[model samples]
Target: MEKIKISKDEVTHVAHLARLEFGEAETEKFTAQLNGILRYMDKLNEVDTNGVEPVTHAIARKNAFREDAVNASLPPEASLANAPESRGGCFLVPKVIE
Candidate 1:
């Protein structure tokens, strides 16, 4: 299997691009972890998958859905009974966006 090499400089460059700053120890730790993961992926590339079919999920699945039905909803007063704040039959929340 081919070996994966992750240099400290390369890791630092990636961290810079991601706007992340890491200590020397953390950078070294991430470098080693990334190299290990790449090496494992390279090993996986050596597997024989000639007859194996690619699947989105491990198990076969079919959509299991129930028929939609109309139902009566609670009255506005009842629905907002437990709300912290309400006005004009609607929940009132602080403005979020400028």
Candidate 2:
């Protein structure tokens, strides 16, 4: 793998852009991590994918949707049977947000 260099100034600039204040130890750690990721990406770039067809997903999957058919509806009382509290066929809940 090609050795990718990350300068302190670059790390500092990135930190500033991200609104992050990093100590010396954190800066060095992040610099190493970023370089390592770049090196890995470079290694991936070397891969040959000449004949392979690009696809959204690795596995072939189709949308399995059931036939849309109107059916008999449940009664309001039966539907609201498990509700903790109900008023005039509506659920009662504490008010949220101002």
Candidate 3:
């Protein structure tokens, strides 16, 4: 059996931080589960990863965005044509800040 890596108090503190309420039994269960996970992590640390390259993602990812290209946009005169009020080729609105 693995030694205790997480205590009941630590589990309760984490629950408080996450705004979660747990009874005594739930806290005990979580403490045991967390300790098991930490012990498994300790086992994983013993593996040799010296030759492995660090990766940002588990699998390869391709750029999902469309190719950037120059495109014509609506002219300023056309844009301000529908404004409630316009001043010097720009839309005018009420002052938002003092």
Candidate 4:
């Protein structure tokens, strides 16, 4: 017989922490499913990964983005062109906080 990885009480506790409501049948089902997943992970641990390089993505891809370039800064006049109210060199707005 295989040893169970997660118990019913532990599943119930986890459900409570997640604010989830479940019946006895649902709890039992979740316990079995979680145990199955853990057992598969345990099986995966048996594989020897001595000299394998970890990869971020499964497929190769090119950088589909434009190169960054330096640009001239916008003048105060151009920046405040569309402003409803500009005081000195900035936009003026109603007071939000007291």
Q: For model 2, state the Cα shift of residue 36 in Å.
A: 1.0
List, residue by residue over 23-79, the lDDT tens digit for candidate 2.
999989989899987777777667899898889878877996778998889999998
lDDT of 1 by residue, 1-98 (tens): 54557788999999999999899999989998999887777777788999999898888779977679877899899999999999999999999998
For every model shown, the clashing-pair count is: 0, 0, 0, 0
lDDT-superior candidate, 3 or 4:
4
Alpha-carbon runs more than 4 Å astray in model 1: 1-24, 70-98
What's the lDDT for all of these models?
0.89, 0.85, 0.88, 0.90
Local accuracy of candidate 3 as per-residue lDDT tens digits, 69-93: 9789999999999999999998899
Overlapping backbone residue pairs in candidate 4 total 0
On lDDT, the stronger of 2 and 4 is: 4
Number of clashing residue pairs, candidate 1 = 0
Top TM-score prediction, candidate number: 3
**Worst 10 contiguous positions by lDDT, candidate 3:** 58-67
Query: Which model scores highest in lDDT?
Result: 4
What candidate 2 gets wrong by more than 4 Å, as runs, is 47-98
